[model samples]
Every structure is written in structure tokens, then in C-alpha cells.
Target: MTAAVFNHEGPWTEEEYLALGETQQRVELFDGSLHVTPAPTPRHQNISGELRAALRAPVREAGLHVLEAVNVRLRPGRIPIPDLVITGPIDFDELNVEAGDVRLVCEIISPSNASTDKVLKMHYYAAAGIEWYLLVEQDSGTMHLYRRRGGHYTEQSVTRPGDLLVLTEPVKATIRPEDLVP
Candidate 1:
């Protein structure tokens, strides 16, 4: 992953922003700038919804909490709202599960976000010590799996719609790219 230049719009404190009490907005803090994510595309939304649905049973049985588009505070004041997040042994009082509690982070690559997803976000997630990262690219109808290795990510596998996504940690579950396609 290449280094991302710090070019941000502005700063946002968690307190001031969380008080807004709004929903369905994807807000992130990149290099101290507030990056507001656009409403997901139809395909992106569908894929995320399906992936969340598929993981529900397994995660619940394992006594894990699954959240959609929740702010994960990667650093002191930097948070990135991942598409789907699975965390373990939670204390509901604090939802801001830092990069450590993150078991798996999934991203349904939007058309415009493909580069950010593959490059910048990939770099951040790896640096943050996320264990597993899954990317579903709609245009090519493929899923790329990555596993963190000593502060970096190694491409585990790239599978098409019909192939199953296998992971070693969190739980034994299968992900089909077709289930994630719009």
C-alpha cells in the first residue's frame, strides 16, 4: 500500500458529531478531515445487505456482535465506518471498538471508492491490525480476501461469484460472491 497524503477538508470531534443523531450517513475521518460518504449505490447496498444477512447466524451463534456501517475508531480521532463489522465480547456501553476488537472488516467496493478501498483504506486497515479484510468488487463480480501479516496484508485469494470465501479466524463461514452481487 502506498502512503496516503494528508489532504482533508476539516476536523470533527466525536462528541459534536455524534450528537447530530442522524442515520444512514457514512462519515469518516481521514487525516483529520471529515469525509462524508455518499449513499451507497444500489449494487453496493445490495451486496452489503446480503453479506450482513449471511453472516448473521454464524456470528450470533459464536456470541459475537455484528454491526453495519458503524464508526470504528482506528486511532485517537480517526474513525472509518466499515460496511460490515464483527466484534467479540462486547460491552455495549462503548460502541467505539478500536482497531483491536475488529475481527473482520468487509467492504463492498463502490465504483468511485474502488481505488480508496484497494489502496488507502487497505493500508489503514492493515496498519490498524485488523485480522481479516474482505473486498467485493461489483464491476468484476469478484471477491478479494486479505489477511494481515505483521502490519501488512497478503492477498489470500480472489474468487468469482460462485466461489466460497474461507476464513481462519472469527468463525468458519462461507461467502459466495454471487450472494454479494447486485
Candidate 2:
């Protein structure tokens, strides 16, 4: 694995970011700046795990790849580590997957970084042509599912704990929001 660039002072290029060493804490690049975020809380992991479990079977059956907490390199200076990401076959020895290689990207909104997940990262995902973006809210098990169209992500469904999320765009998976909560 390449070192995660650890600079937040000024804007840095993606090459510069990748050449840097990794940090003990989880780090990500956004708009040429490095942002260090703490490891996921137990609650966050629970939610992420549940969602990953739910999608794994279907994704695999469809011959797609799913991973958690991996880097989606949208472009230079705009690399975001989504909580969960589903994409096509990935090459070995590749440090990061390009956004274009992604079919779907999911983020379990971290309370400390909800805004970035909702706004900045969402914009980056959309611009990169990722077709699906699943936003998981831990506490309520609410999901704001999105699909890219016209260069933006629009809500495909707003599902709650009681509702089943049926997705057909990126893949076919029937998921329950409550099942994703810890």
C-alpha cells in the first residue's frame, strides 16, 4: 500500500498525497487537502457491517466487487474513503480504485463528518460518474439512496427502518434500513 499523504496546511496534488506515508488514524484527501478522521466507532462499524453483509451475496452473485473503507480516487486532490464501496473487478497491487471503476459507493455518515459526506463527497462522487450513492444514517437506520442523473445525484428513495430498500440501478438488492443499525 502507498503511504497516505498527511498534509492539511495547503492544497496538495494527488501524486504528492499518495507518496506520503499512512497515518494511524484514517486519513482522506479532499480538494487537494488532507483530512484525518478517527477510526469508525463501534456503532458506525455495526451499521457498515450490516449493510455490507446484506449486499455481499447479491453483489457477488452479479459478479461485482464490494469492499469497505477503501479509497475511491475520483481525481487528483479528490480522494474520498467511503464507508463501503461496490465496484467491478479490481486489479491486484493497485493502491486505490478509480471512481470510474466504481458502480456504487456507500457512506455510513460519521456524525463528526456528516457534512462532508453529504455535500463535498457527494459532489465528488457524482462528478466522477458513480451511478449509485447510498447514505446510511446510523442512529435511525434511515437511508437516503441516490442515483446519478444530469451530472447530479437525486434521491431514488428515502427509506426508514421499517421500509425495504429495493435498488435496481447499480445492482439488485433488497435491503432493510433497520437491519443496518447496530
Candidate 3:
């Protein structure tokens, strides 16, 4: 496995990035640069699992697919791995999915990566034609849902720990925010 590239190794091209070997850590591509992050903690995994569980039946019923921490190539120089992705079942040979293939992209905000998730990724997902984006607050069990409109996204729902989060766009599923915590 390739070691994490910490320092600026100069801007990387798409081909160069794809040719590199995979490591256990998370590495995102943005504007031809590489940003490597550490693996998620157990708390992050728990939240992702809870939501995935809640959505499984609904996703199957609707004939949609859900995956965890997969690479999404939104554009040539933009790639982001969301905590979960809700999209149609697609058959492809590549290691990543195009942003157009995704209906909803979910990110659980890590304390140190809040800005990247809330700002940078939010903008990228919207710009790439992803219709829905879910930003989960890892510590507080809050979900901020954003819907794309006119090249941008606007907040559609702010669900708290006790709220029964009802998603209606790509599919209909009811989730409890509290269940997202361990």
C-alpha cells in the first residue's frame, strides 16, 4: 500500500491519482490536489451503520442502492468519498461513480473536518448535479438536509436527535436521529 502523502507533492492529475495504489486512509482529490485524511473513528462508523440500516429496506423497495465511503468522481479534478451514497444501481468497471449517478450524498462531520464537509464538499456535490445532500453532525445527532436548486443547494430539513427524519426525495424513509449514535 502507498503511504499517505502528507506534504504538497504538487498538483496531481486524474490519471496520476488513479494509478496510485490504495491505502487504508481516506484521500480526496480537489482541483488537482490531494488531501489525505485519517480513518474514521468507531463513532463515525456507528452513525453510518445506523443510517444505512434504517434506509436498507426503503432503498431495496425503491430499487435504489446504498453504499458506504465510496469514491465519487464528481468531475475530472474533484473526488469525494461520502459517508454514504444513495444512488441507482449502476454497472461499471471503474473504481468510482460519477456525481450524476448519485441521488443523495451523506457526510458525517468529523470534528476536525467540519469545514471541508460543510463547505467544500457541499459546494462540490451541488455543482455536480447531486440533487440531495445530507450533512450529519457526528456528536449531536443532527441532520441538515440540503436540496439542489438552480446550481446550488438550500436547506430543506434540520432534524434533531428525537425527530423522526422523513426523507422524501429520492425515496421515502423514516429515521430516528438518536439511533445514529452508539
Candidate 4:
């Protein structure tokens, strides 16, 4: 099979960005630019797995789905692969999920992408009309939940390691940040 080759230049169009297909690293499109990020660290993956386990049952009961590191098309020229997402039913053949189908988007923050997750993605998710935003800080074992209010988000709760994060919207689930890591 032949490899796909393209110019490594900026101002990439949506079709051009999608043409890169599945890559070894995470690639996202933002404002006509392609942003490439390395894969998550082991600790990050562990936390993500734990959180997924915690939310699985509850989300399933609500007839929703929880996915990890999937392409979410927020709008034209904007697609991000969130750490975790709670979404409605999706077809198996689809390349990406639309923002409307996504009820919640979670980001496990590491030192490398702290600012991007906390600020940039936060703004984009909110503007996309995704109802819930979850931020998990890998270093501190802290979780922050936000709910969309108009075109922005309002912090609903912040739970630390020892405390339990009780969520009702999108799905009903309780998670303890401390349990996210071994």
C-alpha cells in the first residue's frame, strides 16, 4: 500500500486535515491549522481507564456511551480528540461524532497540555454547545465539572482526591479522584 503524503504547511483546509487520516499521534484541526500532540503518558491512560470504568454503568443505564480519544467535530475546521466523551448513540461506521451528540467532554490535564485543555478546549467545547465539560488534573487528582450556560460554561463542582464527584446531568455517576490512579 502507498503512504499518504501532503505538504506540512499551515492554513490547512478541513478536507486536507481529514486526509491525513489516522495518525500515530493525535492530530486536531483548529482555525485552519493542524495541531499535533503526542500520545498520552501511561499515568494518563490509567486515569482515563479508571474514570471510564467509573462512568460506564451509569452512562449505560442512561442509554449513552462513553468513548476515549475519538474525533469530535465541533464545527467546520474544528475537530478535537477529547480524552473522554459521553455521547449518544453513534453508528459504527462514522468517522467522527458531531458536537450535538456529545453530552460531555473530559480532558485529563497533564503538564504538557494544561493551558490548552483548561482554556482553549474549554472555550471551544462551550461554544460548540456541548452541555458538560469535565477536567481531571492528573498531578493533583482534582476534577472540575462545568455546565454550559448560554455560549459559556459555569463551574458546577470541583472534587479533590478524597472527595466524591457526584454528577447528575448527562448521566448519574459518582467518582473519586484518588481512585483514578494506582
Candidate 5:
């Protein structure tokens, strides 16, 4: 589905934002424009859960917060609900993300969201100064990791179901490839 380019001038409020959450659909708000994405499949959920479980131990011990599918406000009207996001301390509220609290954000790629996740969201996340971005594609069983550098993502690494994800920032959290594949 495509979202019309609205002539809206005001910022979308919390109520209006939450109202759209009913469909259980995933969409991102960028400068008053909305980009809608399809709901993930069962395999997507399994991989996401696996990623969460792999990191939960280190995250909890380090007092870091790991959240799934929450709106991370990048600017006045730019908010993207990353599939998985980890912060030092997390706020469970719907519209809770500020600018820099998010250390690493991730997305699980499905057929409908491949381009947006790999290109659009990658650029935006780098611009937002989020330290790391992880993209997992369940179809191919591949994970691509990107690290932000000088307002852009400079490091790109690809891993399959047997590799390990080594993160550089926040904490040195690692995830085996098997842990991320459904």
C-alpha cells in the first residue's frame, strides 16, 4: 500500500499516532509522511525472538534495555518502529524514543520491506546517529550489520546461520548466526 503525500504542516500527536496502531501494521512517519509496511510472518517472529533471547542475558546484566517493535522518534516528524532496538535504559511507552538514547536498532527484512529497510531506513538511522543497525533477512537466512560513521554507515558485514554478530558500540554483544535464524 502507498501513503499519499499529505499537505500536513503540524506534527502528529501521540493520540493520532497510537490510533494507527490498531491494525498491527508497521509504518514509519517521516516528515509528516507515513510509510506503511506489512506485518511480519511467523518465521520473522521466531528470528526476532531468537535475537532477543541471545542478547537478553548480556543486556540485563549490563543494565541495558532491549525492546521490540517500538516507535523511535528521530526528528519532529520522523519516527520508525524498528523490529528490535537496544538502549542502555529503555522506556516502555509507545512514543518514548528521543534522539540519542538508542544505541543500536535492527530490522527484519521481508519481501515487502526489503528496499525500505536496506536503503531508506539505513540512511535515516545513520543520519539519526544511532550507533549500529542490523538487518536480518529470514528468506535468505542472512544478517547484514552496519555501523554509523560520520553521519553515514561505513561498515557492512554479512553473516549466515553459522556466523557470529560482533557489535562495536554500547557493549560487546555477540550473537551466533544460528541464534538469529528461525
Candidate 6:
């Protein structure tokens, strides 16, 4: 839906936030506040699709679920729709996945969400005890992987265009940055 549907002047309650229902744009709830982001561009979709395809086999082999654009409830009133999530068993009937079940969350950075992805969400994901975070910077053709350490995230690796991103913790998979785009 449109932002007009959320014309209230105060912070939204979790019930109200959920009541807003499926939106055309990406909508998240943080501290009772709503953060609305525009739908991703075609290039962003291409990268997400490609990355998901690359991770699918290995992630599934590890007995994990790799999902796209799914609601992740970090805590009460703190639900974020991550671009990609590698999670443990979750019932398909549930509206969202719990933070405890999630192993990794990935976000493909675009101009509009660079800061949020690189900083804000990083802190949130780490604080919630999620083990890994993957960031794909489309403009630079790079991917940065982070591992959680003591309520914070430490950079695990940075893979550039010509190199392969080899990950083994959550799953064993290798991906090339350039291959993320068409």
C-alpha cells in the first residue's frame, strides 16, 4: 500500500503496523516507528535473484531455508523485511520469522538504502544475535561479509569483482561479485 495509509501522527503500534498489510513498497517497523522504502530497481532484483540462485543449493543442502524479501521479527515492534534470509526451520503458515531462527540476513545496497544497510541494520542484526550479515554493494561490484562477535559485527571478508566470496560458516558457497548482475 501507500504511505497515505499510515497518516497517523504518532508511532505505530505493532498491531497497527501489522494491520497495514502487504505493501507495494518495503515497510518495516522499528521502535514503534515505520520506515518505508521504495521498491527496488530492476538491477537490484537481478542481483538478489542471482545471489539467491547461487546460494540455494548449498544453503538447502545445509538444511536451511533461503528466502527473499521476508519479514524478520527481530523483537517486538522491530520487524524488518530483509532482502534475503538464511533461516532454520520455519512454518510456511507464519507471517514472519523469529530472530532466533535466523542465521544470516543479506541486503543488496542501493543508493537509497546504502547508509541504512551499512550501518543501522548492521547494528540491529548484530544486537539481535544473528550470526552473519552479507552486504552487496552494486555500484562497486563488491560483497562484504560480517560475523557477529560480542553483540557487534566484525568484517569477515570483502570480495571484489574479480574474486570469489567463499563462505563456510552458515553454508559452504562461493560467489563472484560480477555474477550478481546480468
RMSD of each: 5.4, 2.7, 1.7, 2.1, 3.4, 1.2
- Per-residue lDDT tens digits for candidate 3, residues 114-144, read 9999899999999999999999998878999
lDDT of 4 at 139: 79
* Number of residue pairs clashing in candidate 5, backbone atoms closer than 3 angstroms, sequence gap of 3 or more or interchain: 0
Q: Candidate 3: where are CA atoms >4 Å away? A: 1-9
Q: What do the candidate models score in CA lDDT, each in turn?
A: 0.77, 0.84, 0.88, 0.90, 0.77, 0.90
CA lDDT of 112 in candidate 5? Answer: 73
Better of 3 and 4 by lDDT: 4
| Residue 169 of model 2, lDDT score | 56
Clash numbers, per candidate: 0, 0, 0, 0, 0, 2
Candidate 2: residue 148 lDDT (0-100): 95
Cα error, residue 31 of model 6, in Å, equals 0.6
Note the residue pairs that clash in candidate 4.
none
Candidate 5, position 44, lDDT: 93
Backbone clash total for model 3 is 0
TM-score of 6: 0.96
lDDT of 4: 0.90
By lDDT, rank the candidates, best first. 6, 4, 3, 2, 1, 5
lDDT of each residue in 106-148, candidate 6, tens digit only: 9999898789999999999998999999999877559999999
TM-scores for all candidates: the values are: 0.85, 0.91, 0.94, 0.94, 0.84, 0.96
What lDDT tens digits, residue by residue, belong to model 1 across residues 10-69? 465666445444445576767656666778888787888888888888888887877788
Higher TM-score: candidate 2 or 6? 6
Model 2 gets an lDDT of: 0.84
Give the poorly placed runs of model 2, Cα more than 4 Å off.
Answer: 1-10
- Which residue pairs come into collision in candidate 1? none
Model 2's C-alpha root-mean-square deviation from the true structure amounts to 2.7
Candidate 4 TM-score over all chains jointly: 0.94
Off by over 4 Å in 4: 1-6
